[model samples]
Target: MNSKKMVLIGLVLTAFFSSLAVFELIPGLLMAFLLLSVGIAVTYYFALSRMRLESLAGISILLKAAKEIGKESKAPEISRQLGLWAQRLVKSEAVLVWWQGEWAFGDEEFTAWPGLETAREWVKNNNEVLVLNQNGGEIFSHPWPSNINSLLGLPLMVAGEAAGILFLLNESKRGYFVPQDSEALEVICQQAAAALNKARDYQEVEYFYKEILFSMLNALDSRFPGFTGHSQRVARVAVLLGSKLGLDEEELRILEYAALLHDAGKVFFLQEGLPGEAGELEEMDKELSVLPMEEHPPLGAQILPDEGVFARICQGILYHHERYDGSGYPEGLSRTDIPLAARIIAVADLYDALTRLAPEEERLEPEFAIKEMKKTMGMLLDPLVVIVLEEVERELDEIT
Candidate 1:
């Protein structure tokens, strides 16, 4: 670039000297002209260099934004990342991500831009790259906060429709938002739109699946008189225990699903040839010599979808019946061999059973249930999980 600039400057100097000779200007005036030409050439070169450098910086920022935003699988996080990236890339004072009707703000120092309804409404209808930079000694004609002298809006388009809009305000330390910033924002929005839309779809689908799971669990629980709200109470207690054990969010989610579906095996208790109905499965199990209660774990695990995320949930359900001392059914997984979720659910299951769902004569208060559970530690329950259950006694009592 410097070499090209030198070549261009040489051509310009050659042209200028030839003009000077043809015009036969006085020496003093000629010297002044030469100085002016040199200064102009130098300023032009520096300006071009700065523009080139800024262009490169914008490209690098866009690449980073696309890579980071594409890596995210959640809509809220995707919008947040895009907002923060835009704020950093363009040095904006504030960024607002309007994701599907939800709004998220990214700020440098938490300055609120008031009275943005007109601008937002206009941008929503226009659905284009709108820029409001009135730096040429002109006041903003739009109804905007005096503090916000400049603004940029980019629509997040998915499948030819707008899924969201991004708004940036007060760029580059209160300076006008340049054209380069707008171009960079357009590229970033193009990259993020599809990802954000897909994340929204996945989120909705996941929520729907959970609703179905809860509905099914409710139906299963309703089949037995004593099992009313049984799965939900177990889930609450399991989550408390899982939290006490320091399980992360994802771990706690799997634990909760497993607890809710722990009794899913009992869904088969209503199958053909079984004798008893409405929570009398134990009597039915003995009378018909049919499939026993211990066999429901595998059946329940089999009923769930085979997705990889649900793998731990299935394992938890499959092994919830297993004992820590190798005395339980099916695989008889012992000690740490039982999945952590299974162990936690095992503790929750017994605790809820003894306190709330058990026969009236067998039922104990929540505190007493914990005390009874203590005796089974390391034999029927994971010792660590049982200890954590004791820690959650205060909360458990309220729920039970």
Candidate 2:
């Protein structure tokens, strides 16, 4: 009962029992009423205090989750953190969060959790939170854990679009998630959605920037007559080689960008009308690829944006033409002095140049290209990179 109603009831009991005692009708009954009233009042006060404390705790946790979510900028990392927070917020045994991808937390052995997929679809279609509990629903018909009779599914909206779904499953003696639990989760989802949108925006901007860079690389390819798709092919091979060599994601990314832009420097020195068709380059212009050593590598490095994330990529490009035994271009840096990305790109670049369908004098048969690469392994290319290249070639051969 509400505090006002309880108070009125207590007062009425007080007067009723006191009247009996005043007439000496039943002093014992008056004593019993006094004890009962005091007990009820104390119990009511503690219950209210407990509810207030629980509410405050939920608010505090929500704020904490928001603060942590704001600190992450990567989509995957943000999803992970948010999933963890949701699990904690609802004290759920398992939480599933889905954005561009999905993450599951807690004990996920319950494969038969009914209505999960349906709930996801329902939230997506309706763009609203849905709660399922055993209070009066058929959703709990499926055999569930003794304590897990409720599911709270909230749609994570980003920029007016449903970006993801957050599910909280109850599997404890706490009975089931109540309406207040859903309310608290809704507040947390608001913050999570904002963070997710911010991270997604950052990702989209990065992707757009990379797209422009790729276009510029393609334009550079058009200038080299027979090398139209050389950059992209080299990048693909380089990524494959980098993976075989155990390069981490960051390293592979740098290698891919460098492979695409490795020849960007040659664009500055092309003679007029030199970039027409295959074999259109005059004999004199062909010599420019080898001569003027410092020009292309350093020039390509200078051509790339050196102030931000591309700086390392520029380094990779600058050294890609360097020889493994200190006999190559620009810096003549040998072995370990050459960046690993440059080493991997060098192998990929040379392999593509030899095997791709270029001029009659330039292109080599696939078998011949492999033989030629093996011949130059330790002298012109890093031995480790060449090994990865061979692995990639073997895999490709099997696929063929």
Candidate 3:
């Protein structure tokens, strides 16, 4: 028998012997002690079994919730899922706040509650989960409104750094939290922190990949004089158009990558004559010119897949030079058959090329470049994209 059962049996035997001494009934005391011991043992056995089952049920709930959270990538959805579970389990209001350099309550969905800003700052500064008993009858002073009696603030740590806090509130009952409650929250927080850190590490790895790709592009830019700033300019214009088009986060990423590395194949075209040498064309330049421009599209498509954002970007790089009519190279896709990202990059790239100072030609003025872009609409470029580019050019001109 467990310690609890043993203690109950000892108490019953003691009571029975004492009663026998007072009433002088020896046989009755023996029967009474035997029956009391049997009853106490049975009761304690059932109570212990029930306690073990309840503990298992609590653990199962946490495990199920953690599994569901692991599959989600969106922040708002994760918060909502956790909040719903908290509401069901604790009968309390739960809010999952996010940190974007600074903490903001989970996408403005729970902004009506007061004192969240202070609470967020506290979590950010301390990097430790806090359990506050808000009811005046309890230990800690209430930081929220009178209706909110208890608070549990869990820091969502990512990669050993705090990312945000998960806040749960109990409005009706105060001082109900025990040491066991805090321990459960700590377990949940640790699981959440691990998942969040994995996600953050994935994002950081992607950023590093993009940085490496851009560094390669920058090196290629250095190989050609008068083109030192060309890729950077194109990237700026592409990002501008991407924002104006209301591209989603994923699409914006693809567009940025394409713009930064569209001229990747130009690395293969670097001539030995150098940028401004004024010498005869080398055999390498002649060979490069004849090496099939059609291959550039496929070559870029091959190199970009390792960077997770490049599936869409490869299409942009391969088809950025394709004309709106069927007169373009490679696939010869025309009109809307061309991807929108490719179409946007085409306009931005051509505009930058036209305005840049070449070795033999004067730099085209912004007005002239806009006019020329308009002239080529529906033939060399997508007409609608040209309209957007014109607007972008005007805005850029005003800023300058």
Quick one: best lDDT, which candidate?
Answer: 1
lDDT of 3 by residue, 247-305 (tens): 86556766877777777766544433323322222221211121134555666666666
What lDDT score goes with residue 202 in model 3? 47
Q: What is the lDDT of residue 50 in candidate 1?
A: 85
Per-prediction TM-score to the true structure, in the order listed:
0.55, 0.50, 0.50
Write candidate 2's Cα lDDT for 1-400 as tens digits: 5666766777787777777777888878657878587768857776997899997987898899888876666767776787788778767767777675454333455434555666666778788777777663553344555667778788898767667888877765666776666676776678778877766655543674477666666655556546677777878888888888887655676687788788777666554343345434333122112223356778878866674456878888899877888877778999989988888888877777666634567667767777877877778888888876766676644322
Q: How far is 386's C-alpha from truth in model 3 (Å)?
A: 0.6
The candidate that wins on TM-score is 1
Clash pairs for candidate 2: none
Off by over 4 Å in 3: 1-206, 209-211, 268-292, 306-308, 398-400
Report residue 287 deviation for candidate 1 (angstroms).
21
Q: Which whole-number lDDT from 0 to 100 does residue 38 have in model 3?
A: 71
TM-score of 1: 0.55
lDDT of each: 0.72, 0.70, 0.65
Q: How accurate is candidate 1 locally (lDDT)?
A: 0.72
